[model samples]
Target: MKNALSRGLLLSTAIVGSLSLYSLTTKVAVVTADADNAGLKLPAGFGALVVAETGARARHLAVTPQGNIYVKLNRPNKEGKGILVLHEGPTGKATITGGFGSYGGTGVYANAGYLYATSDEEVFRYKLNSKGEVTNPTQPEKIVTGLINRHQHESKSITLDKEGNIYVNIGAYSNSCQVKDRQKGSLGMPNCPILDSAGGIWQFRADKLNQTYGTGTRYATGLRNVVGLDWNSQTNQLYVMQHGRDQLHDIFPELYDTKQSAELPAECLYALKKGDNAGWPYMYYDNTQHKRMMAPEYGGDGKKVSPGNYIEPAAAYPAHTAPNALLFYTGTMFPEKYRNGAFIAFHGSWNRAPEPQKGYYVVFQPFKDGKPSGDWEVFADNFAGSSEKVATGRADHKPCGLAQGADGSLYVSDDKKGTIYRIVYNKK
Candidate 1:
């Protein structure tokens, strides 16, 4: 019995030590020099490569089964209104196939034998040929139009499930539901008047084109900004990453410090269903308590929980990581453990002061039996050079979109540098 107890203690110590070592290596690291952008030097069996560099402020991406890549850019005037297509030829190089842009925003996806792209006010579809190239590019059928465009949080992220149901993210224009707008201590709408229009996810039919603003039903509500959204095939559900509201310290100095501000309100990842309400203006994710917390403007301290009202996120991240893209990994290139995990592109933080900034990298959160089982790890990094002090205020690239190629490779887009990277595991 004594030997058994000793054996147990020794095993426990070994397991803890192993986990500590992995955490130290995988946790977010600070980078400051331009050399860091040469692409991360991974473990012996893995590698990363930069596939495309068009300087187009690329935001999101969709890759067809035949290995062609489609990138969506945020610059309206330069990139125009259609989607940018890049072809990977036999030489393993990437070249622009074509540029199509009638309108511009940050939403783009490939679904149901068509390329569905969304701008500030509308969604359009283009037919594709067998080669994964856009055919009949001259014609774009408007799937949805006439959405709100108030110049704040105007991007409408689009996604589709297996059931042919389409979903669009309509972010709230108001910051913190302010009555006077961006003012501290101001009251939100008594009944959240914005619910009638924005602050929700609306559902539409994928086959229905040119549907007006009121054509769809409100599928979910209370999301401030959800630029990153995707459908999880294994779960048959839609997942969204909300870009948490900023300036917590600036808004409530009495309750928050600069460091806390950088790390307080958790950026949230939610699984949505019809009629789901994720409290946005009235509540925010508290990273410390790991729960939905009431907003200060809604009459509560930082400690007060917003119960029975807001849907809790499946997972929470540090404040201001600015998760701009979400993708479920269904690839076999990496270890078997990553088969059902999720990858998030955090564009990094801007308001977290008095310290080195974090994020601007890719993180992989593993799942087991549909539940998060391990700590999130940095799958890719060194995007903004290699110095903490330098990267705090300046960055060469901020990750905005994530996509997995049909060949099981990964694609990442950077809005800051307007670059696209294709990361594949090199069997060495």
Candidate 2:
């Protein structure tokens, strides 16, 4: 009888010992960078590292509390996987541990014990374990499905507020809601039928299961396309960067010159509330004039002003900058000046031809008390490799996504090069 009891005690001891070893092996290391940030250019005392060169086209990413990084790919990998889970090693390198989600997508976020991601037509979420890894990677719950994915501007970038609501950008398929889209002589459609289902931000319950388009509410309207958006916890409101309508001079040469087209309508940043409309198709904010001008399709020349009631943009940028990701910094690792400021990833422009393509960098917009306190400045540059590449619109890496790590480091994803860069600040 004594031998039997001794055998059971030894077995339990062996099992516990095995678990301890396993935990040590699985423990993730905190990532840090060298004094000089690899190759990326930044301000003094800031550094970055090309932590992972993910071969997949990384779109948007989310970092968990445990430093686990999940990236949503714009295209499936060679193995037909669309999402990648990365584990950081003690040496500050990250390795792709698992890849799943067959459908390719652009939006990925982690919140409320779930990792929320989006395909062009649906929004899905995976339950996260205590270690911040996906508990069920193979099968995620479809939170929202059957969205309008018409192939043009269909990427559904998403963000969740502190409340239970999740916002998704449903970009308009048509550039200007024209009667004959993109045609030179096309007129703007009256009442703009696309606004009924698209061209806006939609809000849905984050924790709800299997919601359809009918189950969501249109939070804001008249946005042509919004790839960059975030919920600012400081302001307790939603902010979005709208991709202004394109082909201003191509289709309306008589109204606008090539130089004017390249820089006329401003890419706008808007702080939004429910039921807010920024007036697309009818009017566009002119950064030069600092006023909302009537669009050519709406029967207006370049000099004509619109009488339509449209909310003014909180800030405006050069046309076709293509802000793809918006992040409000709330971390203490950076200096106090960075708090509540916004970092925007400009994916670069292709439409500003014959002048010079611009915006292959990230910019910082200062904010105080939820409003723009000062001018925006280029935070990171040289993503295009050289000035010639910027002029010709040839970019080595176009920044697509922005994420904040638990350690207050910034992560930027480049879809063109499938690279992930981690930016950190060290006081001099």
Among these predicted structures, which one has the highest lDDT?
Answer: 2
- Once fitted onto the true fold, the runs of candidate 1 whose alpha carbons sit more than 4 angstroms away are 1-37, 41-44, 77-82, 389-391
> Candidate 1 residues 1-428, lDDT tens each?
00011112222434322222122322221111123234663444455556678777788888876557888777653546446888865323478877887666888888758888888888888887766777866688888888887878888888888987788889888778778777755666777787778888888888887787678888999988888888888888888999888777777778777777778788888988788999878888887777788787787577888765678788888777789998888866556777878989998887676656778888888887666667888888777766562356587888899988654567888988777776655441
lDDT of 1 at 161: 88
Kindly list the per-residue Cα lDDT of model 2 for residues 90-175, writing each as its tens digit.
54468889898998989999996999999998999899987888988888899999889898889999999998899999999998
RMSD to native for every prediction? 10.7, 8.4
In model 1, state the lDDT of residue 120.
85
Candidate 1's TM-score: 0.87
- Candidate 2 Cα deviation (angstroms), residue 216: 0.8
Give all TM-scores, in the order shown: 0.87, 0.92
Clashing pairs in 2: 37-48
Clashes of each: 14, 1
Please give the CA lDDT of all the candidate structures. Answer: 0.75, 0.86
